[model samples]
Target: MTDTRKSTQNAVGAPGRAADGLAARLVVERGAFRLDVTLTAAPGDVVALLGPNGAGKTTALRALAGLVPLAGGHLRLDGAELDRTPPESRPVGVVFQDYLLFPHLSALDNVAFGPRCHGASRAEARAQAAAWLERMGLAEHAAAKPRRLSGGQAQRVALARALATHPRLLLLDEPLAALDARTRLDVRAQLRRHLADFEAVAVLVTHDPLDAMVLADHLVVIEDGRVVQEGTPADIARHPRTDYIAHLVGLNLYRGQARGHAVQVDGGCVVTTTEDLTGPAFVAFAPGAVTLHRERPAGSSARNLWRCEVAGLQSHGDQIRADLTGELPLAADLTTVAAAELDLRPGATVWATVKAAQTHAYPA
Candidate 1:
């Protein structure tokens, strides 16, 4: 079988002379789980594979590293094909989750191992190793063994070793997963700088949304072995196509942005609000917070009101997810019959309101 794939990215940056990239249409088959994915990363571009646990993110990374064989499809780096190449023969570097340093070797020797395997002279490899160690801020610990190093130090050493060989592609599997929360923050910043300087393709598999958003310019979100959503963080945040992504994209998720005593929409449209907040802020009310009525409330405490057109409706468990497009775009969840009673259909404009007490403001 043949599959057509596209880079799905604008080729704005010309590949530099230092490194090209690694691309793959990977398929792996097993008893109950199968992964089929396609990805292309630029020379300095970091592509993050994000998903929940057991979502085939790691499976895909392993397939690219040749730890597991591809059931079908092709793998390429720069302009060369690498489908049949052995893991060691492939011009790829891997930083596993465990930061698997040699127990008996010093930090410097571990970093030197890759260069040595690549046929550098022992002295040359040691010299290169020293340089890498210093680059990772571990020059003083060159003689320290893995057992003596802290978790963050060990992680940096693993990264230094991966880069020492000067591989064409780098594969990092949950690089920050092993670190403590405090260490993670510092290492994450350091890793970002290193990746920025890396002139090769880098693919990182992570379940953490923060990691994916911080480290990758392009995001490929996989679920059940399929590419569910792929886009920039801003695009995904504004228009969440899936519930999982909705949570990942932080939104106060309010019905209105609170003003002094009113909220404005498009074309001079305004809704009087009871909330009293100054400066730039937001007002939040949930889908479940809204209660629909057959007609506008004659006299009520509800201050915010809108004539909304039902853009779309989706079923989420027992509740209904409603998309409304009118003066302001909004997503509201209501019960099944409430939607039916209001006859919420596309293009049907209905009066929607929320109490001023319900509105809230937070720092943007």
Candidate 2:
């Protein structure tokens, strides 16, 4: 397994310079589950915690917010240790998944609440809140209550509220989850702009790959409470280290022993690849790379071919995704017309082929 801590630490700079940014090894134990992951980010960096449900993304966020107590390890921001700090006292801002705007308060008051709690006078808090609302383009909705505002407006109010206190660290838990698909697209673009203007470290938790890829400067992929991969969005998408990541990035991934350009994958299926690799290796190819036929193709030049059974089928946008089993269990994508021509359905046998040029192999 990769030493994600070392890699991340190196990416941000040396540990001795942790004072310049956010540095922490979060360790939290709950019943049988434990999360031990190292996270580091310089000022102005946006790090997204990308993981599946129950993968400890939320737990790590809570730990940073001082809501969840740490079993071991420390939390530090801008050189200050915050492990024992109370949630209310930490210089951190959190935007919950649900927005959590005070239903009774107007948007102005909701935004001013954070500054008030941080010891600003009513007038000063309101002044700061007003500026943040203006920055968020929600100044016209100052008097609107949470109940009267649209989902997008309410989310902006929540974000404005979090930013009023001038926090050194911002934590957003699925900031765009409440919006509709159309609203999400607009709000996501807006949020990306806002995050770019932020001068402090920001950490966001999300399961949406598109959101993470678009909004985060770096991605930390957590699985079963551990860091499985951490890198730029493009890097992780190009070279997924785990099955979850492979699926998340829309690729069919397999592990096996490599001999030159051939990989002996699971089920004794040998895959021919374009890269020359040896020893333990991983082979990955996009589902679209696979071509399916009712019978084996004769005089085909493709070096990688398998006899597979269609275990299931589902719509994926304009294309159909077929889950296959047998010689090599994998997912394949084909056009609706092609699928119809093949008479693809569960339990149907088919021959799948992929050119060696489509397969990528790398040392595991």
TM-score on alpha carbons, each prediction: 0.68, 0.94
Q: Write the per-residue lDDT of candidate 2 for residues 124-217, one digit (tens) a residue.
A: 8888788888888888999988998998889889988887776778999999988999999999998887777666788999989999999998
RMSD of 2: 5.5
Model 1 scores what on Cα lDDT?
0.76
- Clashing pairs in model 2, backbone N/Cα/C closer than 3 A: none
Please give the TM-score that candidate 1 achieves against the real structure.
0.68
On lDDT, the leading prediction is: 2
Any idea what lDDT model 2 has? 0.89
**Candidate 1 backbone overlaps, count:** 2
Q: Which stretches of candidate 1 lie over 4 Å from their true place?
A: 1-20, 251-364
Over 4 Å off, model 2 = 1-19
